[model samples]
Target: MSVTDEILTPRGPARVDTDVPAGAPVALLVLGHGAGGGVDAPDLLALRDAAVAAGLVVVRVTQPYRVAGRRAPAPAGHLDEAWSVVLGVLRDRHTGLPLVVGGRSSGARVACRTATTVGAAGVVALAFPLHPPGRPERSRAAELGTGLPTLVVNGDRDPFGVPESGPDVRVVTRPGERHDLRGDPSGTAAVVRDWLRDRGWTPA
Candidate 1:
C-alpha cells in the first residue's frame, strides 16, 4: 500500500491523507490528532506511516478547529458535529469494509464517543486519556462502551494507568513511553492489526 494526499469535504474543508492498496479489499482506519496539534503531529504521522506500511488504508483528518487556525479546543457540541461530518466521509468512501476510528489524546476521545453512535466495526484507542495527569478521578472512560472489541494501547506509565485492565477490552502497554506509543510503532500496529483480523476485518 502507498499513501496519497487528498482532501475530503466534510464540514468546511477536511484534509485527508490516505494510504491503502489500490482497489484491494481493505479496512479503513481513521487517524486523528491530539488537542494541541493538527493531523501532522509527529506521533500521529508516525502511526499513520506505520499503519500504511502494514498494508492498511489509513486516513488522517484535520479537525475543524485546526483547520480554522485556532489553538483552543472546539466546544463539545461543535466537536461532535464535526466528527459526524468526518465519519460520514469515511463511511461513504469505504463502504462495506470494516471501519476503525481512533486518535491520539483528545482525538481518541472524540472517536471513541463517536463509535457507539456511528456503528464502526471496532474501535482503536491509541493513548486513550483516562483523565488529566493528576486528576484520575475525573475519568472520561465511560464513553467507551463494551461489546465492541476495543484496542486500548497506552504507555506503561501513561498517567491514567490505562493498562490496569478492563473486562472485555484488549489493552497493550508500551514500556517507558509517554501518552504516545513512541518506541515500538510496528509492535503497536501489530496488536491492532491482529485484533481487527480476528474480527474478520479486510486485510490491509
Candidate 2:
C-alpha cells in the first residue's frame, strides 16, 4: 500500500510518499530527488517498486523547496536539516527497522551528508555527481566517505564525473546511461536490489 504524508521541517513542510510491502518490511529505504527533478523521476520510481517488491518499505521524499514549487534546491545545510527531521519522524513511526537513505544527484549528496547524523544503516547513491560537468578538480568524492556502506550507481557517460569506489563505497556503472539513468531505470533498480540482497537487507 502507498500513503502520502506531510512533514514539518526547519526550512518548511516536506512531503513523503511511503510504499509498504504486503508482507512485513525487512528495511526502510528513503529516497530523495535530484535538484532539477521531483519524486517521480524514473529511477526513483523504479527503486521504489523494486524495494517494495523486495519486502522493504520505500519512502520518496519531496524536499520543502520542491513542495513549495521551486525548481532550485535549498542550501545544503538547510536540506540536511530538513532531511534529518523527516528521518526522525519516520524512525518514530517504524521503530527497529533498519534505515537506508539515498537519492539521485543532489539528493544523493544530501543523503551522504546526513547519513551518519540520521543513523542510516546504509546509503544508495544513484547518479552521484562526483563533480560538476567538466570540472574534475572540484571533486565531491568526500561526500561518499560517510563511513557507512554506500552504493553509488552512475552512468558511464555522465557529464558529471563518476565517483570511484572507496573503503565503504561501491561504485556501479550503467553502460550507455547518462546522469539521469533514464535509459534503463529497471536495470539500475536491479543493481540496487542485488545490493540490498547481498547486504541481507532483502530476501535473497
Candidate 3:
C-alpha cells in the first residue's frame, strides 16, 4: 500500500508518495521527479516497485513547482532548498535506515548537489542531463562529485548525453532509449536493484 503526504517547504507545498515493504526495510530511498515531470514517471515508478520488492522503503517526491501546476522549473537554489526541507522530514520518519537519494534529469542534479548536505549514503541519477542539449561546454558533471557511491542510468540515445563512470560512480546505458527512458523501465529498475544489492542495501 502507498501513503501520500503533502509537505510544506520554503517555496510551496511538496507532495510525496511513500511505499514501505512488508518486512523491515534495508534502507530508505527518496526520489524526485524531473523538472517538467511528476512522481509517476515511468522510470521512477518502476524503480519504486523494484525497490519496495527488494525490501527498501521508497518515497517519490513531487517538487513544489510541479505541485503548484507549473511546467517551468524553479531556480536551482530554490529547488535545492525545498528538496532539503522535504528530506529532513522524511529522515525523521524513517530514522536509522540508510538514506539513498536520486531522481531523473533536473531532479537527478538536485539529488547529486544535496546528497552530502542531506547525509545520503548513495545517489541514483537516471537520465542525468550532462548538459543542456547541444551545449556540451556547459557541463554539470561537477555536481556528481558527492564522494558517495552513485549510480547513473541513461539511455544511449539521450540527447542530454551520458555521464562517464567515476571511481565511486557507476553509469549504465540502455540502448535504443532516450531522455524519457520509457523504452525499458524494468531494465532500468533491474540495474538499480542490482546496484542496491551490491551495496548491501537490499537482499541479493
Candidate 4:
C-alpha cells in the first residue's frame, strides 16, 4: 500500500500523489479535482481508492489554482500548463505501462483535450460537466474524441443529463448520482474497472 508523492513545481505548485504496485499490469491513471474541490474531496477519493483496488496505479493531483486555495478557477493557460506538467510526470514515472488521464469536471475537460493529442491509452471521466447545467447551447461534449476507450460515469439526474446521441460512448448513469457521482461508488468502481480492462489494463 505504499504511495509516492511528487510535487510538480513548474508554472505553479501542485502535488501529484499516487498509489501503485511495483510490478503488475500497470496503468497510470491521473485525476484532477473539480473546480470546487481539491484532490481530497470524498468523491475523488472514493474513485481513486476504487482504481487502486482494481490494481491500476492511481494519481490524484490539485490544479495550481486549487493548490493556491482559490475558489474560482485559474486562467485557462495556467490550468493547461498544470495538466501538461503532471501528465509529463506520469509519462516519466510510469514508463512501460499504459497511461489513462482524466479528471472530474474541468480537469476531465483538460484530460479529454490532452488524450486526443497525447495518445493516452484510455480516459475515465467522472461527472463530466457537459454544458454547465442548463446551458446546453454551450456544449462541451465535443471535447470528447473518437478511437480512444472512454468511460463516462455520470449521474442520471445530472444537470446536462445523458447525451444519448453518440456512438462509442460508454455511459454509466447512477440513478441518484449528481454531477459528483455521489452515493455511487460501487457503480463507479465497476464501470472504471471494466473500462480499464477494455483498454488492456487488467489486474495482474
Tens-place lDDT per residue, model 4, 1-204, is 536465665657787777775457467788888887877766677777777777778888878777777889987667777788778777887788788887887787778777866658777787888886788888878777645777787888889655543565677777887777768676676777777766678763
Models sorted by lDDT, best on top: 3, 2, 4, 1
State candidate 3's TM-score. Answer: 0.99
For each candidate, the alpha-carbon lDDT, in order, equals 0.72, 0.95, 0.95, 0.75
Instruction: Tell me the deviation in Å of residue 40 in model 1.
Output: 3.0
Which lDDT tens digits does candidate 2 get at residues 45-141?
Answer: 9999999999999999999999999998889999999999999999999899999999999999999999999999999999999999999999999
As a whole number from 0 to 100, the lDDT of residue 157 in candidate 4 is: 85
Quick one: RMSD of model 4? Answer: 2.1
Give me the runs in candidate 4 sitting further than 4 Å from their true place: 1-6, 22-25
Over 94-191, each residue of candidate 1 has an lDDT whose tens digit, in order, gives 89777788887888878877876777767778888888888878877786664577778888888865734566567787778787667776667667
The superposed Cα distance between candidate 3 and the true structure at residue 202, in angstroms, equals 0.3
Query: How do the residues 55-148 of candidate 3 rate in per-residue lDDT, one tens digit apiece?
Result: 9999999999999999999999999999999999999999999999999999999999999999999999999999899999999999999999
Estimate the lDDT of model 4. Answer: 0.75
Which 10-residue window in model 4 sums to the lowest lDDT? 160-169
